[model samples]
Target: MALLMPASLLMVSATTSADAADAPQNTTNARQAKAKGKAKLVAMPQIVQQGKKPASAGSAKAALTATIKPAKAGRPVALQVQKGKKWKTVSKTKLTKKGLAEFGAPISKGGKALTYRVTAAPYKGAKAVTSKPTTTERWLTASFSDDFTGSTLSPSWSNRGIYYEPDSLRECSKGDPSAVSVSGGTVKLSVIKDPTRANERCVAKKDGKSTGSFDYRLNGHIGTEGSVSMRYGFAAARIKTHKLRGQHGGFWMRPTTAGGGDPRAEIDVVEYFGDKHPQGGLTSFIYSTKNNKAVKTGSWIKSPTSFLKNKKDGWSKNYHVFSVEWTPKMYVFRIDGKETYRTKVGVSDQFQFPILSLLSSDYEISQMPGGDKKLPQTMNVDWVRLWQA
Candidate 1:
C-alpha cells in the first residue's frame, strides 16, 4: 500500500517557502501517477471530534425499509443512515407484519446529501444463511450521465453474431442478426435460455430450458487483443440488467489467445450474479499472467448478509452506469459515479495494457439445494463507452 500523506504536509509558512530539499518521496509519487493518467487514492482528513448527536429538531424525515416476498409473510428489516462520517440508526420495521413493508420518516437534515444502508433477514428456518450484509451507499456527483448515444456498445459489437444477448427478439428476429437493432437510442442486449440450435450460446441464462446437459459457450465477450486491445483509459457502460433470475452480467476485458483459450488476462470491471445469496454480488476482478489466479475486489452493495434478501432489491429493473478507470497503477470500479471498490495490485504486470470487454457468464450459485433452478439466466446491457486521457 502506498502511504497517503495529508495535503497540508506541503504548507509553506510566511517565514520561507518549502524548499525542494525537504520534499517528501510520497508526494512525488502522487504527482507522477497523476501525470500518467492515474487517479491518486488520497485518504480524507480524519474528523477531529464528533460533537454530541444533534437532537431531532427540524421537520425533515425519510423512511427506509426491508421486506420479504409472498405478499404478507416474512421477517423484518433495518436501515442505517450515515451523516458526515458517522452512522446513525434510522428505522426498523416488520416487512410483512405491519402490511407496510416499508419504513419512512422525515430527514430533518436538509441542504446536504444523505446516504443510507439497508439490511434484511431471511424467513424462519429457510436454510438461507446470513453472510456479510449488502450496503447501498451513494453520494451525489455532478459528472453522472444518463445518456448513451455514441458508446461502443452494440448488439453486434463484434463481427461474429453480436458478442452479447439482444435487447429484444423482434430486433433479433427469432435470434437472427437482422432482427437485432439498437432502438430507443440505447444499446440493449437480451437473451433466451432455452435449448438453442446455435453452436455457441449465452450459457449464463437461467431460464431452465436446456434440452440436455450440453456443453454451452457464451455468445458475447469483449477483448482488446488482436485488433481491439486498449492501453489505458476509462471504459464505461450505461447498462440496464435483464431479469437474469440466475445469471451474471457486467463489463470485463480479457486477452485473446491464438489457439484455444485466452491465457492473456481477464479484467472484470463489474460482475453481478443475480442470485439470492451472500455470494452473489457486484464484483471487480483480474485474472492475470500464466497462473490464472483471480486478484479481485468488489463490494456487496446489496444482500451481503443473505442471498434471499438480495432478490428484493430489483437489480434487473434499474439502470446502473458501470465504469472502470484503468491506469498504469490502479483500477477503480464505479456504479452511477459512486466508487464501490478500488484495487492496486500487480499494477505494473497485469494492467500494463488491458483490453476492454463487456461480458456475461453463468454457473451454479452453490453446491447446495435449490441451486439447479437458477441456471439459464440472462444479463442485459444498454451501452458502453471508453474515455482516453
Candidate 2:
C-alpha cells in the first residue's frame, strides 16, 4: 500500500493545478506492467458531487468522476453501477493524463441515491481493478451543467425580461419567450421579428446611435441571475450560429442583480456575428462601464480559416466549444480547444451568472444582409457546462 500513497494524495486533493503537475511523472513506470503485480485498489473518496442536491429520480447529465492508481492515461475505463444483482457498465471514457475518468448517466432523478464505481482494464502484467462503490450525494452538490436534452429550459434559468429584467443586457433589444425553444437536443435562441412590436415604439436614445430607427427585435435569452453565480470557474457552451448578419449570438456572464454588488466587469465568453465578415465573426470581449465610458479588451479571432474541424465549416454552420477558463488572475477564452484570447486586465473577481443571447443592437443593425428577410435567425446551444475551482 505504501506505493499507493501518492495516488491517494491526488484523490484527496482532487488534482488541482498545484498537484496536477506531478501526475504525468507518476504514470511513467519503468516496467509499464512488465513487472508482475496484482491489481490493487488505492484508497479514494467514495462520493462524487453532481449538483448542490442529489438529482431527482429521472435526472440526466448528472456526472460521476473518478481517478485510478497506476495511472491509466489515455486508456479506456469502464464506469459501472451495481444494478439488480450485478454490476452493469453504464458508460466508458479514456483516463486523462492525470488518471481521471468522468462519465454520467441518467440517475434516479427523484428517488434514492445511486452508487457508481469505475473499473480499469488489465494492461501489461497488471490485472483489472475496480474502485470501491461511491454513492451519489443528495441534492445540494456544487458545479452544474445542462445538456439541453429536455424540451424546456431547466428551472435553473429565468427567461429574463419575461418577469424581472428587460431584454438584452444593453437594453438595445427586448426578449420574447416565444423566441426561445429547445429542439433536436439543443436550445435555440432565435432572433425573430416581433411583428407585434415592429412598429410599436422606440424611446429616446436607442442609445441614439445607428442608421435605422429602433425597429424592435425579439431575441432568445436566459440568465442564471438568482439561481447561481460563481467567482471563478470554467464556463462553456457548444453552439452553432445562424447565417444572417443582422443579429449576433453570444455567451456571457453578468454579476448577480443584488443591490450593492460590484459592477466592476462583465465576462463575455464568445460572440458571433452572423455568417462571413472580417475577423471570422467571432469575438471574445471583456467590458467595464463603471464610470460612464466603456473600457474593453479582446477582439475577433483572426485567421480562423483553419480553426474549424475543416475549411468547409464556419462558425454559423458548425458547433464550436467556446469557453472561458476563469482564474483569479486571468480569463482565457478559447474556441474548440484553441486559445482565442486571454487577458488579466479586466477579469471579474466577483460572482457572475451566465447569459445566452442573440441580439441585434441598434448599433449593428446595418450589418445584417437582406434586412427582415433574414428574420428568425437562431443561436443553437447544445449544452453549457461549468466547473468551479
Candidate 3:
C-alpha cells in the first residue's frame, strides 16, 4: 500500500488572548460613574490561518472571527470553531469574544477552499448568526497512510473473474485475462482482444513484442472489497502513463450488492482516455444501477477535462495525483486536493457503495488510432486507499 507521510516534523500549540486598550482612568466619582456606563467592547476573534501550514499546493485558508461584548453575569458565552467540508469539530468552548480565534485544522488551500466563520448567538437563543467567511491561512500536508504499496495479495481482492487476455476484449478464452501478476514491485495485466486464449489471459512482452497471436487485452485490476469498505473517505493515485500510446487509466468505485443481488452503482472517480471532446478534452460518465447490471443509469461525467501544459509539454512523462472523495450523498474530484468536479444525489441509488479498485486498460487498442501500430502501451498504478469516516 502506498502511504503519505508528513515531510516535516513540527508541532505548534493553539492559543488565544484578550485584545483590550488600556487607558489611564480619571480619579473622580462623577467621572467613574460616566465610565461605568461605557465599557470597551472587544471584536470577535479571527483565525489568522487555517493551520500551521497549507492543505495542498495552491490551497489557502478561509478564516473568520466574531466581535462580541463580554457576556453579562456568570453565564459564559462559549465559542467554537468547526470544519465545514469534513464537518469535523476543531476548537470549542472558547471564551474570547474579540481579537482572534485559532482553528488550525487542515482545509482545502485552493479551488473553493474550506473556510471558518464566526457564529454568534445569545447563550439562550435558538440559533446563532454566522458571519461571512474570511480567508486567512494556508492548508498544509498531514500524515500519510499506506493505502496501496505492497506485493502480498489480501482477501480484499477476489481474483475471481476470468483473467483478462492481453490485447483483446473477448471472454471465456483459453488464456483468460484475469490472471494479472504483481511481482517485485510492479503490477501487471494483459489488455488483449482475443477471447480464446487460456483462462482468457495474455501477457505483454518486455522486448515490446506480442506474446500471443490473439492480440488479447489483459491487465491487472485490484480493489479493497473485503479489506476496506468506508462510508465516507478519500482515495487517490499517483500514476504516469506509458509514452506515445493512448490508454484508459483511472481511480473509480462501484457499490457492492447484497447477496450479489442488489443494484450496482459506479462512480468514475477519474477516467482519462486521450479522446478529445469539444467541451474539453476527456470524456467520462457516472453510472448507477438498481441491480447488478440489471438497470444502468448514467450522467455525463466532467472534470480534468482540460489538460495542463508547461510551455509545449503534454500529458506524458509526468505523475499526477488523481483523487476523489465519497460522501454519503455526493462525490468530489480533486487533483492534488483542488476540487474540480462535485456532484450530488438526492436519493441513494445504492450503486456507489463498494471500496473501489485501481484499474488500467490496454484493451480495445484496435479501436484507438494507431493502436495496432503501437506495439507497446502500458498504464502504471501508484496507489489506492480508503479513508475511514
Clashes of 2: 20
Candidates in order have lDDT scores of: 0.39, 0.64, 0.39
Candidate 1 whole-model C-alpha lDDT, 0 to 1: 0.39
After superposition, candidate 2 runs with Cα above 4 Å error: 1-142, 161-172, 198-210, 213-215, 289-294
Q: Where does the lowest 10-residue lDDT sum fall in candidate 3?
A: 38-47
Query: Which digits, one per residue and each the tens of the lDDT, describe model 1 over residues 1-389?
Result: 11232232221111112235544479764443333111011111110111121111122122222323322445555555666676666666554543223443333244444545444444452211111222221111112222324444432244233433334211111222322234444544433332454454333222443322322323333333454444354556545454443335556765444434535455677676554546555667765543565444444554332212244334455455566656667776655433456777534223222222223333332321333353333444444445433
Candidate 1, residue 23: how far the Cα is off, in Å: 28
Tell me each candidate's TM-score. Answer: 0.43, 0.60, 0.48
What is the Cα-based TM-score of model 1? Answer: 0.43
The residue-level lDDT of candidate 2 at 50 comes to 25
> Model 3 over residues 152-216: C-alpha lDDT tens digits?
55455544234444343332122222434444433443333443433434333423544333244
Candidate 2 lDDT, 106-202, residue by residue in tens:
4443555565667777654345666666555432233777777768888888776542123433344667788899866788998876677766644
* Number of the top-ranking candidate, with lDDT as the measure: 2
Model 2, residue 351: distance off in Å is: 0.7
Query: Model 3 segments beyond 4 Å from truth?
Result: 1-155, 158-160, 163-214, 242-247, 258-261, 275-284, 290-315, 346-364, 373-375
